[model samples]
Target chain A: MKNYFSSQFKLGILGGGQLGKMMLYDTRKYDIQTYVLDPSNEAPSKVACNHFTQGSLMDYETVLNFGRKVDVLTFEIESVNIDALETLEKEGIKVYPQPSVLRNIQDKGVQKDFYKKHNIPTASYEKYAFAKAVKESPQWLDNLPFIWKSCTGGYDGKGVSVVRTASDLDTLPEVPCIAEKMIPFKNELAVIVARNVSGEVKTYPVVEMEFHPEANQVEYVICPARIDETVAQKARDIAEKVSNAFGHVGLLAVEMFQTENDEILVNEVAPRPHNSGHYSIEGSFTNQFEQHLRAILDLPLGNTDSKVASVMVNLVGDEGYTGPVKYENIEHIMGMDGVTPHIYGKKETRPFRKMGHVTIVDHNIEKARTVAEKVKGSIKVIAQ
Target chain B: MKNYFSSQFKLGILGGGQLGKMMLYDTRKYDIQTYVLDPSNEAPSKVACNHFTQGSLMDYETVLNFGRKVDVLTFEIESVNIDALETLEKEGIKVYPQPSVLRNIQDKGVQKDFYKKHNIPTASYEKYAFAKAVKESPQWLDNLPFIWKSCTGGYDGKGVSVVRTASDLDTLPEVPCIAEKMIPFKNELAVIVARNVSGEVKTYPVVEMEFHPEANQVEYVICPARIDETVAQKARDIAEKVSNAFGHVGLLAVEMFQTENDEILVNEVAPRPHNSGHYSIEGSFTNQFEQHLRAILDLPLGNTDSKVASVMVNLVGDEGYTGPVKYENIEHIMGMDGVTPHIYGKKETRPFRKMGHVTIVDHNIEKARTVAEKVKGSIKVIAQ
Candidate 1:
């Protein structure tokens, strides 16, 4: 008579950002008891959870203390205290994605090495204990223009530099890092794979990530990617392989590059609900957030089929605005059929900050893409 | 801009039942601050809302006091204090479905009278000042068999009785009532029409109600009811007419009966989210819960078109199992594709009490209906 729904079976979530807020929607739906911890008192998920503990996720004591109080511990981000997670696992607490998986993923060097050792198709790369080593021996890069990524704490295009020239290497911070051979890829794609403790696995459809040409930031995520069926299948198979290789319990979003030769190569991975799958909220039979919970809880995985074609346009804060946030033309886009805008509840807007996103769905993929473009042009996330 | 999203502009909701819990999902998506009040401290919406207050919804002081704190107030239940709502409205607080609408709907006699006065087609019914009056003048009821309903406080299958003979009248409560002429309806149907404060209105697809032969309770609600197009259209038009007649803001669920001759007659009305529209949560582009919020907030109504066919099966507590609730065979049903169970978070389950609902969606109506049947037979809400 284990009662997870509407009982004292507490499920502690490690981060309380928009991803957690979205995940809480399913937890609330199932009446599953949830406790969330975050550094900010004003986290988007601060209100929806049954319990909210304001603490640092990186602090070993804070994470361990919180983990011991819950029956199962899962996180929305990989930046948490892995040592504390290992301790919690040793003490018989259930940690989804397992501490071992997080340990490898916590640093780019370990993640890339794991990929290489497992024969995962990723760009050939060399890891440096220090960024200065690459400068000290220019031959370490092998090529003129390599992608230099900091081994730790690189997120949302930060801590990643394109060494187009020798001076570009001088601009890089002196830290342990990896230099990946640049691939002239045609498109960036992502596949979210869900695996449970019992080993049941499922993968969502391939989604193409369209980047802002100038900023090189992902702007639109279109599901049922406008790629060849074989390519889509290849990407999904690769993602499932990654999930199996990691023995991950929960959602693992595998980002990949579709090389010019039609070959798919792994770019990186996020072991949580990813932005690329946000379209699932309105488009898929089972949303990624809910699927993540089902996987971690070992509940039966839901259907990952898309009910409609969709495109998700991220509502990054307008460059010139900062202060109280205002979603200009939000009502206008909401007037469009099948357009849903998800506001992350952040009060103030800063330049290029992730403020919210809009999902446009339609039976016709082209039509959905067109509406998504229109939504992108109309809505402006600016401060009032 | 008032900045309702993530701002101090609060939405006060009365009655924190499953309906309120479902509405809170949308509020979370929009990041709208909400405050919910319910009598029980273990209300389903308690966890999701920004603030929760424990109080009797029908109390004048409680309703008035809660109403004063928020810019806009709405109730998911019809049993709230109409007098207090009127007072609040006069004191500058906005209450959707104004107190006048509730006053008309709070009594069966008044509601029926209003339906007749508005030229709405409905079964002919004779109202009596008391049950004794009907017993005294049996000839007033031309037919021997008719439906008996209490003038006030009747909900679900309660406070209503079927009178077949003089002996049947004796079993009735001695109170003000009405006897409706039994139409021998071919099917029971419901249409949820949403109207915004700006007078814009929309009607959801007609849903057929399949009542349990023994309990006489709604067993399943099948959307896009298996009826002729013109009949469905007629039902929808009638529903829209009812919504316009009431001039109500928010959702008004219009229950109707299709006569042997295919005439659609008004059965009753609920000026809030109703059980019949529950299937829309997974079927329609805009779920009824979200539509209700949009209507109350004067936001543009979303597309009510069905993205996929769906049928909803109620998960009522099994008779003779009245204690802590347990959803037996829940995992078996969850394993089925496109099956979604919504646990209502009611810790204690009484006989025939609504514990939750399961929605089955598929491209084919017949397939969804079949899965819904399997779901009904498989999952049991029993005492642990």
Candidate 2:
């Protein structure tokens, strides 16, 4: 085995967000040298890595130049330049999750096709160059109440809309997009699957995503989703199948919709550490970020079992509060047992902005959920 | 409570050792800005903090200058300049474990006297101006096999020696020192007491320090020391007494010797995170480093209860190896259940140097110990 600890071995990370910051906890543990690149100099990962380069991840030349200086390159965000990763791979540098997987999943048009080809369970969707073209489709009009999603640059409900009529389509942005038959699902669940370079695989327990009633944003993520054991097993199995099909090295967070009749259908997947797995930091035997590093390096995977049942509450910026961030009553919540809040180093607070997250772990999932609600209610991410 | 997260609030740490690096994990979690100072630019904490300043922690001006830029000041090492801490305290920099506590425990003779004055139990000892004077004294000469420790500047068994004969004293430096009667103890145990500025106190479970027979260095730190419940209670009570007596504001690692008759005698104390408490990182509800930061910040102290039994094995550099460090077969140990290695980020290795540590955790202490032995046997720190 190659010596990666306390040596000249360099691990390059393509994004310097909180995911990369969390990964550094494990990298620093092994004393592995790291070079991180992100578009912002104020990125959360800037301080924890050996080298921090501020550059566009989508700019081919910038990514290629950064990738050339490191031995093994991986990314926290999948939006990075796949062409640069391909060049790095050709030059004998290791690119985890392989650039082809990112390219296949980068566009919803292509990703949906790949899923269909692999016999993956997903909602049937129609692609369009513009919202008017999608509206003009007679077949899509017949299938009313479809989900209109921008093919690219969509995150956290920003580029998604539940279109109920032709007028909803009229207000939609003129961007390349996909219109999918909206499923009246019973629940939105997620499973995190880890695949190493050596093809070893492990999956975390299924998690139930509780969304805000009005905003439709994930408010709480409860692990060991309060679903049937068989359904949980099926979710995990499908997640593993998805990971195997992609042949992605590192973590693949599979988001799925659990239909009213209990059929699990894939919604999407992120090829890096995902928000849904944040509870792993306090609940599981190994956290998602650490697991990603282990998988990327092809190290023996750790036990994916949960040491304790856990719940995660996202700390988004309070509505109508947009300035320097302040986590009010954070100490009151911290006084509770097993409550850990992760402040994402983002200094500002804007309505609906991702500020941080809180993990509450307990031997009893119900008790953890109870505390999570208390945590969600007690702290306010406001402008001080 | 003061909002230290993502603001101008700065926490200044005087030493840049592994302890500070571990503390940064919690600080970074809260997005609290920190300034770390160390003599070496290659200190383990350099990469993890917002600011890194190269300066002598022992130099009054250097420490004061660094302390002036932060809202709160703390140190990982106890050998820092006490006078500088005093100045910082007077200036309201909120130095934890106040400089008076450091001054009282700065000298071995003074520490022993404080213990005696406070009615704290300890072994009988004598203080000498020099090693020759210790040997020349008739009464000290009568007491052979006493432990000779330099009154000041002793660390990691370097300034300590077991004086059995006149020849043993010949090689010692002529410095102010102390001679203590060596007592046969059943076990060497430690209890880390965390006290907040609010005067709240909590003690961790007793840990047994297993030493290398030849090197006299701690090889394994086993938490929840295999001892009687009453004895464990006594150890914790005494540790609390020590913390209260010194009015310490952060973690005070109180090392003790358990006599054959189950008598607990104080050996020494460190005012910051201690090696014996390293197992808490994996075993306890809240790790020692995080607890230290919470205590200093006057935040409610976290639970000190054990989540799992754990054993920490130090990864000291193997004898006759002195170059870039390498952990041979690290992957082999990573494959084991509940094993985590913390590399100190020191690139070079020499015999008996503390390069890193591996923690083995299990629900059962016996199982953890068995796995710890396997971990200790499988991995070796060597020069490349």
Clashing pairs in 2: none
lDDT of 2 by residue, A1-384 (tens): 778888889999999998899899889988899999999988999989999999999999999999999999999987899999999999999999899899888888889988999999999898899998986788888888889988888777778898888888899999999999899899899999998888889999999999987666799999979999999999999999999899999999999999999999999999999999999888877889888988999998887887778899999998999999999998888888888889999888899888999998888899999999999989999999
C-alpha lDDT of candidate 1 relative to the true structure: 0.90
Q: What ranges in model 2 sit over 4 Å off?
A: A136-140, B135-143
By TM-score, how accurate is candidate 1? 0.98
Superposed Cα deviation of residue B262, candidate 2 (Å)? 1.4
lDDT of 2 by residue, B218-329 (tens): 9999989999999999999999998889999999999999999999999999999989988887677788888898899988888888877889999999999999888999
- In model 1, what lDDT does residue A205 have? 97
How far is B6's C-alpha from truth in model 2 (Å)? Answer: 0.2
What is the model-wide C-alpha lDDT for candidate 2? Answer: 0.90
Q: Runs in model 1 with CA error above 4 Å?
A: A136-142, B139-142
Worst 10 residues of 1 chain B by lDDT: B135-144
Clashes of each: 0, 0
Candidate 1 residue pairs that clash: none
Best by TM-score: 1
